[model samples]
Target: AQSVTQLDSQVPVFEEAPVELRCNYSSSVSVYLFWYVQYPNQGLQLLLKYLSGSTLVKGINGFEAEFNKSQTSFHLRKPSVHISDTAEYFCAVHEGSQGNLIFGKGTKLSVKP
Candidate 1:
């Protein structure tokens, strides 16, 4: 069994301010982690992923995440955020392969001026 918790329903941050979106996952076996961002009416975009090897993974839009296997946590972070960065973020996990997948409710990021 696998599940995801976003921890926050919403995150507010000023433009150019650093932001971090916390995510925690639980699973019975090894799984792949991913962070996806969905703007307005667009489809979900791959933010970053943690498969193996490096603990730190970088993605588009200057975003990065560190994979912590001990704690089973993979939190996404951005040094500086822009106004356009406002969107809905989702943390997902694929158990073993891409067959069984679980996703968090979502965390809406509101970037103010």
Candidate 2:
């Protein structure tokens, strides 16, 4: 079984400041990792994914994540943030030939001016 854990429940940052959302996963077998973002009153959108090959994966809206196999971490980072970036971010993992995804509780990003 695979599971995801978001280290922080909420992240408050000033506009234009950098932010990092921590995500850790536990799995007995190889897994596929993903990050999704959901704006207010909207469905979750794919931010980035890591299935194979590159360890560093880039996503929409200036977001990127590095897949660390040894540590079992895939932390998302952005050089700067905007007020529009305020939303809920979820980390998910798929494992064992199943198409199902196990998601974290989520981290709320609150960007302020």
Candidate 3:
């Protein structure tokens, strides 16, 4: 079974500042990685993925992450963020066999303008 752990439950930052949200995963087999964002009661939107490529992957809203196989980490980062970036971010892993995704509890990003 694969699982994701979001180290930070909440991250508060000032507007236009850099931010980083840590994510770690444990999987026995190869897995598809994803970062998703949710605004309030809205559904989640894909931010980025580490399907198969370079270690670095970029996503919407100026966010990016590096897939570290050894560390089993896929941390989200942004050089400069906006107040609107305040949302719930989730790190997920999909097991190919089960065709299901297991998501982290969530990391609430609060950006103060």
TM-score of each: 0.94, 0.96, 0.96
lDDT tens string, model 2, 21-47? 999999867779999999999999999
lDDT value, candidate 3, whole model: 0.94
Which window of ten consecutive residues has the lowest lDDT sum in model 2?
A: 93-102
**lDDT (C-alpha, whole model) for all candidates:** 0.92, 0.95, 0.94
In the range 1-113, model 3's lDDT, one tens digit per residue, is 77999999999999999999999999866768999999998999999999987999999989999999999999999999898999999999997666788999999999998
Among residues 3 or more apart in sequence or in different chains, the pairs in candidate 3 whose N, CA or C atoms overlap within 3 Å are: none
Best by lDDT: 2
Clashes of each: 0, 0, 0
Give the clash total for candidate 1: 0
Distance (Å) between predicted and true CA of 2, model 3? 0.7
Off by over 4 Å in 3: none
Q: Looking at candidate 2, what is the lDDT of residue 55?
A: 99
Error of 1 at 84 (Å): 0.8
- Native RMSD of candidate 2 (Å): 0.9
